[model samples]
Target: MTAPSPACREDVRRTLAYLTAVGYGGTAMEVWQWLYRPSRAWSLEEVMVALDAQVAEAKVDVMQGRYALAGHGARMADRHERYLSSDKKMQSARWFLRVMRLIPGVRAVAVCNSLSHEMASEKSDIDLFVITRSRALWCVRFFALLPLSLLRRRPGHRTRHPICLSFFLSDASLDLRDVHLKPDDPHMAHWLLSTVPMIDDGVFADCIHANAWARELFPNAQSPRVAWYRRLACLRPLSWSLPFWLERVLEQFQLERLPSEIRTRMNGSTDVIINEHMLKFHTNDRRLEYRERFLSLARVQK
Candidate 1:
């Protein structure tokens, strides 16, 4: 391979540093796919050559075909173990999506966070981003939580591979830039890019179109590859056609029953948003923390 240009080498190092901060590594193709170059797209051969140059300079390490920071080569082993755990969690997520599909108003369901990145640990609960019909947000949340609560598969009930129904948005409100942490939020940008849709009734494309800002952060990143099993469709419509008044009734009922913690935190900020368009119940958001860590690591490499 020809010697990589200085700009290509810097881009490769920054990408590896970001991944290292997130507790994982990547293969050559993975590096190219996740490459952090907002200005221009780089070819796979360019990224590979840059990675090879970094390895030669003792700035990066490769193990079993995976690349990491110089002293973080062990992350490849951890990543492999987490990949196995992620496979099992994905199987469980698929089963849960089948059940969710039976409910009304569910427009799209995508796996997010660690699981979407294929880096979930054994204890990591499955995190999902759901999209419901406009004005049916609260009603859909009620039904979606009902079955999981009864089966003891929710976060507090199930210790291993539990499901976390934290974030939800209505189809009318697909742009997520408002919920981001102000000026520059790298984590949220990557999160939006990483979501893997399990059940999409044409809403996934709309959602992506709504958040085109993510392309500015990762110009070369493509939409996540949809698995064959995740292509299931909701053939028969059910109670989704209910009147708007009933939706308001269900919304009030669910609001009253919300846990005290969520009630107190509701609408306080983006971390625990609660309204008609979106229902995000994350009491402990870590986007700021991850952003800081990534910046710190990237600066050190520079």
Candidate 2:
């Protein structure tokens, strides 16, 4: 087989390296969809040809229609098991997002992180990324969490499918580039591309457009399309007449009840951000860790 061009080979290697770091493999289509830091846009045909060349060179392995770095075939069976787990989690996420739509001010709710990538394990908690109306950040969060807390579905509840509401962005702060780790943040770029919106009021599209910078990293990646079956219409009428002051009240109430760890870490940096436009409570952010692991894998491959 003919060798892939340098750029194609590097892109293919980088894509596999990142997926391997996350303990997953990719089909040809997924490699194309999650192409990382490509020097330029690459067509699906081109990516397939590149992958074929890598396989011929013993640099990559293809099993059951999935591709991974050589000696990594052992993960395919585990990935399939996780795929089954993800299906059950997705059903739970869809049901939760449906209820979330009825709670006013919620513009969009997306299945993110491990679940979004369909790599959730049996013990994994569902991670959701929420988008709310400009000034309804806290109100939407309070209402969204109240029922989940009551039902013991939130994190720490020991539920089989606990939901983790760690990230929220107001419509006014749709652009997420500011929150990305400095220098090169490949994980953040992929995270943005992987989000699967379950409930959308047009805000998901706006958020994707706002973060056009991701294209610089994933030039060929397209915004994920929410299936017609998964898309739930928002009940805007419920929040239409809500007083603006109510947001402040809810914000204060939640702030006072926040655990000391979160309160002390609030606004310390992007990891535990808390402001009028965004609420991101990732006390143990792993973007940097993932980036380092991906780089280490890429180096070993070289």
TM-score of each: 0.93, 0.93
**lDDT of the structure predicted as candidate 1:** 0.83
| Residue 201 error, candidate 2, Å | 1.0
Cα lDDT tens digits, model 1, 59-117, are 99999889998988987777778888998898877677887787788888889999988
Error of 2 at 167 (Å): 0.5
Clashes in candidate 1: how many?
A: 0
lDDT of 2 by residue, 43-139 (tens): 8888899999889889998887889998886787677788889988887776677678777788888888888878899999999999988889898
**Number of the predicted model whose lDDT against the real structure is largest:** 2
Can you list the residue pairs that collide in candidate 1?
A: none
